[model samples]
Every structure is written in structure tokens, then in C-alpha cells.
Target: MTFAFPVVPRYSEIDQQGVVFFGHYLTWCDEAFTAFQASVGYPYPEMIADGVDIQIVHASLDYGSSVHWGDLVELVVENEKVGTTSLTSRVSVRRRSRSDEGWSDAVTVQLVHVCVDASAFTKVPVPPRLVEGLAAARA
Candidate 1:
């Protein structure tokens, strides 16, 4: 299952060459993830209020094509692997423009997030509620 988010590229997100900066890909991924969680009824604020926090343990991105300012991008987020306490999400970004029509994979990213106790900062099992929420979102 994939969650799609429409993204509007900002001028500040681009470099001098008029292409999105490499580091901005990570920020895009983060935004997509947050949107995914919210769509699944597990918004970050609610999770934090419940003493649960997810921290990125690992992240990587591969840029295949350049995204310029004003290009609308669709960020597709999916679960690559889900474990007891950690999960890896795959994010694919595609530029929504005729010139970049063939660029179905402008960027591909993988991020591993570990569920943790906010106060203790120790890894914890992902709550059943979250799992159910994600499952429902997929459905």
C-alpha cells in the first residue's frame, strides 16, 4: 500500500542551479512520513502525548532526476518492513510535469524508524493501536 502526498517545491528548497538540493530530499521524506502518520490517525502530537516517539535510526536517499522549483511532486510512501519495534519506510518522489513525465522515480528513499519511550528514550514495541491504524489506512 502507498500513501501519496502532493508536494509543492519551494524556491528555498532549491540550490543555485535551480534544482532541489540533495539534502532537501530528506526533509521531503520526513514530511511525507508525518503526513502518512496523520492520515492513519496516528498524528505525531497524539503519539507524543501518549509518551511514544519514533526516531529515525537510519535513512538513505538516491536521486535519479532533478526537481526544480514550482514543480508539483507526488511523494509516495510505503512500508518496506515492519517489525516489533522498528519499521522501514520506502519513499518515492515523482515530478508531475510533462517534461519529467518519464521520471517516475525522481528520488527513492528508505528510512528506518524505531519506536521509543519519550522519557526514557528506550526502544519500545509499536503499540497495537498504531499497527491497527496503519492497517486501516492501507485498507
Candidate 2:
């Protein structure tokens, strides 16, 4: 994992089944991506200021288990791949049991973001600096 972002399940996010709603997992993934970028020192605002930005072109999730309302969930993030103008990130959601401190896989999500011109919002080449940043994060 390149970075970790922790989030506690809140009551407002719970569904009728007493588990975290399925959709919230996506939000957590997005938040984790933001945190990941900041960790690499190319936060969204800075990236934009540098005339580059990213937009999600696709996302897919596979569920292993449900996250309960009281579970301690952590999103383990990693940049899986980078294309000429796109990037793919893997955000693994794990629920850590408080009693035993063991983690159970909850969801695996792949978020593909395309690099774009900050002002035009058109496709753009991935910056070399960004590439190096991702590599650093991978370490």
C-alpha cells in the first residue's frame, strides 16, 4: 500500500441492513485518492495550478464483505498503473476488528482518472513530475 486513510463508519451512512451503504465506498475511495495526491506533494489545487487535473473516467468495485456501522475502516491506496494520459488507482477497503486488531477485506475499487488540461478540461499528457511523484508514492 502506498498510503492509508482511516474513516469510521457513521450512523448517517448506515443502511437498513445496519451496514455501511454500498455507495459510500466510492466516496472513501475518492477521498483516499485526494490524500494520496497530497502525500505525493501534488495536491489537487497544486496540480490544477500547474495546468493539469484529473477526472474519473471509470470506476469498478468488488465486494468481499460489508462494513458495519461501528467498524474501523481504512482505505489502503496504491497507484496501480499509469497510461499516456490516464492513471488507475486501487483502493482496498479493509475493516479492522477492534477486539483482535485483525483486518478483513471489505471492498476493492479501481478508479481510473484521465489527465486533463486544467482550463480546457481536455485530454493532456501526464506530467513527468506527476509520474515521478506516483513512483515515489509507490515506494
C-alpha TM-scores of all predictions? 0.90, 0.94
Q: Which parts of model 1 are misplaced by more than 4 Å? A: 98-103
Model 2 steric clash pairs:
none
- The top-ranked prediction according to TM-score is 2
lDDT of 1 by residue, 18-57 (tens): 8999988888899999999888788989999999999999
Which residue pairs in candidate 1 have backbone atoms (N, alpha carbon, C) closer than 3 angstroms, thus clashing?
none
lDDT of 2 by residue, 1-139 (tens): 3588999888999999988888999988889899988888788888888999999999999999988877889999999998999999988999976674689888999999999998899999888788989988777
For candidate 1, the lDDT comes to 0.86
Backbone clashes, candidate 2: 0
Lowest lDDT 10-mer window, candidate 1? 96-105
Error of 2 at 52 (Å): 1.4
Q: For each candidate, what is the lDDT? A: 0.86, 0.89
- Superpose all Cα atoms of candidate 1 onto the true structure and report the RMSD in Å to 1 decimal: 1.7
Give the number of the best model, judged by lDDT: 2
